[model samples]
Each structure stands twice: as C-alpha cells, then as structure tokens.
Target: MPSSIFINQLYRPPSSSSPETLPSPNTGVRAFHQSLPGYKPSPLVSVPAIAARQGIRWCLVKDETERLGLPAFKILGASWATYRALGERLGLRENGDVVSLQRLAEAAKAEGVVLFAATDGNHGRAVARMAGYLGVGARIYVPSLLDEEAISKIRGEGAEVVVYDGDYDQTVLATKVAAENHAEGKGVLISDTALTVDDETANWIVEGYQTMFDEMEEQVLEITGTRTITHVVTPVGVGSLTQAVVTHFQRTPRSPKPMVIAVEPKSAACLKASLEAGEMTSVKTEYTICTGMCCGTLSAIGWPMLKSGISAAVAVEDSDVDTATKNLQSCGINAGPCGAASLAALESLSSGEELALGPQSVVVLLCTEGRRGYEMRSNSQPEP
Candidate 1:
C-alpha cells in the first residue's frame, strides 16, 4: 500500500470458469469479461478455524473483501452494468477505474455521450470508473449527507459531483430525477438501479456475480474437499447482489438448495420486509452504520426472486455490524459494515452460541468487502 493512502469501505464481487454444460437459455447472461471494471476476486479465503471448530462444518468466507482495493460487493454489479451500457452506446468497453471521465470520453464512438448515477458510495465510484474508461464525461449525484471522504475518493476518479441536501435515498431520487431531466432536456440518461433489477444490462451485471460464487465454490473444495454448500449468507440493499447469489445457487445443479440468508440493517431491511410480506414493499428508509445496505425500496427484479428463493431474511442492528467487523478483524480480515452483515446475521441465527454443525454441513459467509469501512471506525488508524 502507498504511504499516502488512507482507509475506508467500498463494494464488489468475482470467478468460476464456464461450466462444461451450456448456460440455460433463460438463466442470467454469462459474459466472458477481461480487464473489466468489476473483479473476479478469489473466493476461497481461509478464516480462522473458530467457525469450523464450532461445528459450523464447512464454513467458508467468500472474500471479495480485497476486490479492486475497495471493501464491498457492489463493484461487480456496478462495473458490469457500466460495461454493457457503454457497449450499448459506444460499442467499446470500459475496463478501468471509476475516476476517469476523461478516458471514457476518449473511447466514445458516438458523439456527445455521457453516463450518470446516484449512489451512496461504491456504486458512484463504479459508474465514475466506467465513465472514465468509456465516455466523454460523467457526473454523479450523492446524498448531501454522505461522508466527504468518500466523496473525495469519487471526485479523485474524475467525476463531476452533485450533492443532494438530503439522505442517501434522497440522493438516489434526486439523481434519477436529474438524469430524467437531462435525458428529456438534453439527449440521454444511464440509470444504475435498472441494473439493480431487470434489463439486459442488469441481468448481465448479476451474472458477473457468478464469478464470486465460482471462486467460493473452489475455495470450499480446497478448504473442506466438499462441494456441498449448505448455507450462504449475504448482505442486501436493493437486493441486486443478493439476487445474484440466489440466482447463481438456484441455477447451479446441486441436489439440495443452500439456505440463502439475506441480512440488512434493520432500518433498511427493505428486502427482508418484502420477503415477509410476500411482495415488493417500501419502507421509510433511514441512515445506518451499514450505509451500503440502506435502501428504502425493493428492487422489483430482486424482490420476487428473493421472496421465492431465499430460505430466510434477517434484519440486523448496527451493533451487530460492529461486532461482525471486529470478528473479521480478529480473523485478520477487513470488512465493511455492509460486508459483515452476513456474518452478523449468522451470529444472530446461532443466538450468539457456538454453531453446531454435523459433518455434512458447511456454512459460508461472503465477506464482501475490505478496509473500506475504516472510514466509519471510531479511529481511522492505518489498516494492520
């Protein structure tokens, strides 16, 4: 790491080789991406044996914690979305970081093309990264309340910034409105949430997440020599990545289904509540330690898939997020609050008791980010 670098949270996911069998015709789109914006991070990470000793069985952490040098699982969704969107407009792919609007402009085959989005953090960074690689210019709108440190990082990526004087949700709404206005008044708008749900781009973005699962699958085999994954714990906001996990496992030809547990900050557990209600629903939405999970509305595409497919949905409090982070730290892993939401949920599921797993069971926690949440820590000490 550079001596000048500081710490914080960001989002992303990764890789499995193409299956020998063909991709199902109606399943999520499979893309062979190289040097793309998102990552194909290593999935089979070694955590301390505490989880295994607890009889948690084949517990594994699919660590995207180190992805793109950011600490969250959002990059896969955002970067894939950006790549395809650019392909749609420029016929050229963006294979760079979010901070290069100038680079994107240089790659533009069509005249006067740009990209736009509203995000809490990682999503904006990803959009900016893609725009940097593919467009003439890119702009991002964020909530007035986002951490400035995060904003600085995004700006460093060469994006023009619009700060909405409201919460993150407000930033999302305002950005969408701005993009709509820009499209109507000028020429076009590129929406991120559509990638969070259904649309060819979103679907492809979700498929990119399959790589994350692919790596985990290999890790599980290497660690336990068992292909059986009994449970998978994940964090959700609008449920894009959550759906990605579920969709991947569902399409996978295993006999028994892995329990898909969707964890979120209680205040922003839109998908959890929607699954309970058996339909897509919205909540008031609020701030939480897990900023990445603070979504008020459900992604229409994700809601139905999760409601039908998920084994359980859990809403965790901020304290649990802190605890999950501490636990990951003890294991020498750095994960953001959103990244550790899965471990937090699993901790609650076990009632804080040592897990009791039989030989046949293997539990996996997707540690979705690394050091990115250091910004939210009480002390912004340099990472260990």
Candidate 2:
C-alpha cells in the first residue's frame, strides 16, 4: 500500500507578531497551577540515541507521563480552565486572592454548578480529576468507541460518565447539547475543540495548555544553559496543544521561536487538510490506534494561532506510530501512540531533505501521554 502520510506548509503573514508581546492570560494560569498541591514541572529529557540516529545535536523529550499524577499532560489545561471558569462563576477576579481547590469546590457546590466536558480519554479524565480535587460534580461525555480502559479511568475519578454512541466529534456535539439542556443550569462545558459554538471556554482550554510551554522554557534553559530550541514536533488534536506551543515560542520575549511541525494520524488529518485548503476544514476519519489524535475537526479557537505559527503539518500511518513508540521505549521513554507520533514525524523528516535537521539542531518532541493499557510492539523496521 502507498504510504498514508501527507505534508503541507501553512500560509504565514509577513509581519506576524508573537502573542507574548501582549499581556496574556497564560501568566495567571501558570501561577494558579504552580500554587496547586503536588504541582511540579515535568522532566525535559535528552535522548542521545535518538539524537544520534536523527543526526541532530540534541533531541529533548518533555516527558509529560507523570504530570499532576495523571498519565497524560491534559491536566495542565483542564485544571487551569476549570479554576478560571469556576472563579468567574463565583465573581472572582483574574488576579483574585489565591484559593484552595477545596474552597473552590465549596463555592461551586453552593452555586450548584458542575464541571462538564467531552473528552476522548485524557482530557475527560483530567477534567474528572480536577472535579474530584475541587469537591464538585462532573459529567463527562465520551465516545462509545473509546477503549474500556480509558472509560474506566474517567469513572475512577468520581465523574458521572456518559458514553455516546458515535465518534469523538459526534460526542462533542452530544455533550454540548447536554450542557445546553441541563435544566439545573449547572453544566459548564469545557471542550478542547470548538465548532459552531461559544468558544470562550475553548480559548481558556488553549490558554491553560500554555503552562506546558512555560515549564519547558525554564527546563530547557536549566538543562542546556541556552534557550535554543530549533524545532518542536507535537501531535495535533484539534490544535489546542500545538497552538500553545506555537504561541509560547512566538510570544516569549528574547526566546528563539522554534519551527513547529504538527503530527497527526493520516485518518484524521484535519489540520493538514485545513492548511491545504487555506481554511478550517474537516475530514472523514477512521479509527486509528493513536486515539488521542483521532480528531477529525479543528478547534476554532486554535485555528488562527496554528495558521500563523506552525511551520508544517505531517500525517502518518499506524505503522509509523508503532515504530516510533518502540524506538522511544528503546531510549527508555514510555510513550503512547499519540505521544510517540512526533518522533515518527521526525523519522520521516530526517529521512529526506524536507526538514534538513543537522548536528546543530536542537529538537523538542512533546510526549503528550504515557502508556495506558495500550500494547507497545515493534512491528516494522525504522525508516531510513
């Protein structure tokens, strides 16, 4: 069969300015998260073997496997967005006195507002975890097609789980309708991807992800003694995390903005299709092993940032993900299909002259998740 991979360059403006030059909500989001209990920066690890194989001087992986006691990095965004939205509902200012999750929970309970969201796996679990921490109720909508392992994990967080019979995009719509018809007026929809709906909370979700970049920036400088990040390869699911990475590097003062390449499952390469069409577009998607990146639509809140900041987009096949995951394991890193997809992109780019990675290039791959009952096997040889 022909390779199911696709690549496209985005149209960037001539005089584009970084969002960091302006005041951002991420500053407050970062501070809020830092104050939480058990909050610590995730590790930025250097994989010498992978670097050597790719012919790059440095290959750093920001391991988010253990973030906020979750197997994925979704909590960073879920926690911040939940806190900010809850604070707003309680009439708290942006810079209001720092409050505990318990206090926030009490206020939420009194107001009878329950946190709500639709997630593939990690994001819902993250939201449910936050709801448990804050002592509030959460109603999570998940696709019926989700693996039992992930569904069980979300339920373990004390959230009322509703599995809709459809795909992720359909589940998102169902969750939105449930929130709209919530008679108690307590459901707060915190979706990661936005369609034709109110996207304020979606924007907060994107803002919340900025904490990852903040931590990565500090960690990179601490480890390398130089803030030189030449390239960033991350999985694109509705473009939220990708937007966060792009905006952070673009906006941060005096920081070298790394070229961002987004990786997606070929079956669900919505962002790649969007870029090629020069507009927000959706694609007909089939199930892929990379469940977290199986989004068929782009987030309205994230599209603009990605359009302006991303250097390129690449879509790969399941075999590529399997190879990438096994290779990462050989390097002593545990990554799920979605997390390891970035390395697969790197492998593709390194093989040809597309990316031109060299000895001086320092690349960062965002390993967005840890293995969660997913089998990791090396079924194919690495591409040259």
Candidate 3:
C-alpha cells in the first residue's frame, strides 16, 4: 500500500527465446525514425549529485523531456507506429525514405484514412499530431479523469476529443469499438497497448519505442566509453516502453545485459501485482500524480517478455514522486510526475539494500516526460 519494491523471483538471464515479432537490436526502426523531420536524440544526463548520494558509480538520466517537438517520449512510439500503419495501408515501402510530413500527408489524404486512439494525455496527443501531419482526421478518446489541459492539447491538433465515462482500460476498449464501428470504414486504431498479443499495430508501437533505447545505448557508450549501464529504471504505464527496454537490453551484444527495473504508481501497480501472482493480474487504481502511469492492466503483448525479463518492479507513492520531481528540478531536469517516477524508484531502493546496488553499479533512469501541471499529493489530501 506504500512505496515498495518487488524483486522478481522468476527472473532469468537474457535468453534467445523472446518473441521474434517484437523489436530487436538490429531493427531498422531507428533508421525509419531518423528520416522523420526534426529527428534528434534526446539528452543523456549525468546526475552526479544523485549518484554520490545513492552511492552508485554513475546515475544517468535519459532526458526525453522534449522529443520531436513533443513534451514526452510517447511521440517516438506514436510517430513510428503511425508511419508504419499508414505505410502498410498506402502500399508505401516499409523503412523507405520519408520524403516529408507533407508528402505523407498527401498520400494518406488520398487514401481516406483516419487515426483513432485512447490516451491519458501524451500518447493521444502524439497520435493526433501524427494525424495532423498526414492531413487525416483523428478521434481521440480519454478517460473522464484526464485533466482539461491534456484534453485541450488533443483537441488543438484538430482531433475530436471524446471523453469516456470510465478508466483508461475501458477507454481503450471504447476506442477499439469506435474504430471498428466507423461508418466510413476509414478508422485506424494506433494503440500503443493491446488486449491481444498479436495486434500488428500494437506490435509496431512497441517496435517504434526501440528508437529511445537505441539512442540511450549510444549516449551511454559516449559517456563511459563502454556499455557499462548495469541497471535501467523505467516508468511503466501499460509496459510497452518497458517491453522495448527489456528487448533492447536482452538482445544487446554487451557482455552483461543491464538489470531492468520497472516503476509504477502504487495505486496502479498492475505489473508488480502480476509479477507477484506469477500470472497476469489487474488492479483497481486510485488517483496519482503520475497520471501517465495510472494504468490498471499490463499490456498483453508485453506480458510474456516482462514475465521473465524484468529483474525488479517498484511501486511508489505520489508523495515520493512529488519529492523526486523537486529533486530533478533542483538538478535542472524539468521532469513531470511520470518522468520523475524513475528517480522516485531509485530513491526507494537507496533507502534499503534490496537491489544491492553498490559503487560499481551504473544506473540509467529513463525520464520520459517534461514538466506538467498536477496537484501535489500533500495538498490533495484532506486535513485530519
């Protein structure tokens, strides 16, 4: 019920038996991304102050605060998945040179395609932005609990925003049904998470996320002159990004694959619950400032790999995230609650020796978003 860590007992060393359909270390997804306009690698920052405090050899932060003109890394997956999905429908070459957003817009407009998606915030906005690039219509669905600022951003992209009267999981189902029932038969659901394992678009979304990890590895090598990242702490929503993290590290030729650590809001610790149950499990979530991570279910496509791939799972309280956000800000890292959750997880580990991280351990915290507005937990609680 409080901030806690679960060291996975079923964890195994990286194996070769992972699903072949998912992204691999050798994929051309990054190449595809490189062809997009305004494509640049996000910064990998050294937080020496935190490193010294935590007694770790290095504490690195992959700053995805601003990626591709978006405030979060969700655009990485959204853009790539959008391109791939459109390319398939339009008979465009996969991994072919993307001439420009305008050219893609022309082609997609000629094809009568419309994008449909559900989001807590960032992912839906990314999807809508991509639809705008393609000159296509988009309808974004959101849970009733999403903040108005996020909903407005989605609408700003010229996408019709539909507020679902339920939680994120229900919103996803509503989007799927809406896409399927599109009267014009032109709706394409570009979802990052899926209820089924073999959803092609969902798989592409997972593949799209490899660009972030690829860039992180290159930056880590540049800093250490070797692939020395021993632990990767990631904030988990539906686990798509974390799945990308596990796949990249597991398949990397680096001598030892980095230990994968997943962090989520304590109220929405579905992955941790599933890991403990030795089967996929869902949780009833409550309000958390880490709104992007307030998902109640583990992504079905990611569950198999995450079952054995992750070394540890952490669930942090909103108060912990508030403190982490302030720490990151003091370090000049403008991170939102979701972005700061990785730091919160690290600090949770530092309070005890559960992970046994020592001076030799080199850790990378994936900060996935920039600063955003949210009520602080301390202020949100009613006075006794």
Q: Which candidate ranks first by lDDT, i.e. highest?
A: 3
Residue range 1-384, candidate 1, lDDT tens digits: 111111111111111323343234232222333355453555565564646655565557777776654555566666666655655555453453233334445555246655677777777776676666654467888876567777887898798888878766677667766766774343234444552444565565565666677667677777776677877888777777887887777667675667677787777777766655566778876567677677787665666566666666778777778888888778877777777877788777642212223555677887776655333433233322
Model 1 lDDT, full chain set: 0.63
User: Candidate 3: where are CA atoms >4 Å away?
Assistant: 1-3, 15-23, 94-103, 351-354, 377-384
Across residues 1-384, which tens digit of lDDT does each residue of candidate 3 receive? 433889998888675544465454536678877866688999999999999999998999999899888899998889888887777767666356444556667888987888999999999999998887778999999998888888998899899999999989999999999998986778889998989988888888888888888788789889988888888999999999998888887766775667899999887899999999899999977778888888999889999999999999999889999999999999989999999999999998853455658998899999998999887655356422
> Between 2 and 3, whose TM-score is larger?
3
Local distance difference test scores for all models: 0.63, 0.81, 0.86
- C-alpha RMSD by candidate, in order: 9.1, 4.0, 2.7
Model 3, residue 321: what's the lDDT?
93
- The TM-score leader among the candidates is 3
For model 2, the run of ten residues with the poorest summed lDDT: 375-384
TM-score per candidate, in order?
0.79, 0.91, 0.93
Ranking by lDDT: 3, 2, 1
Q: Name the regions of candidate 1 deviating beyond 4 angstroms.
A: 1-32, 37-40, 52-54, 91-110, 183-192, 195-198, 351-359, 373-384
Better of 1 and 2 by lDDT: 2
- lDDT per residue for candidate 2 within 21-101, as digits (tens), equals 533644677787887778898889999999998899899999987888898999988888888778777876535554666
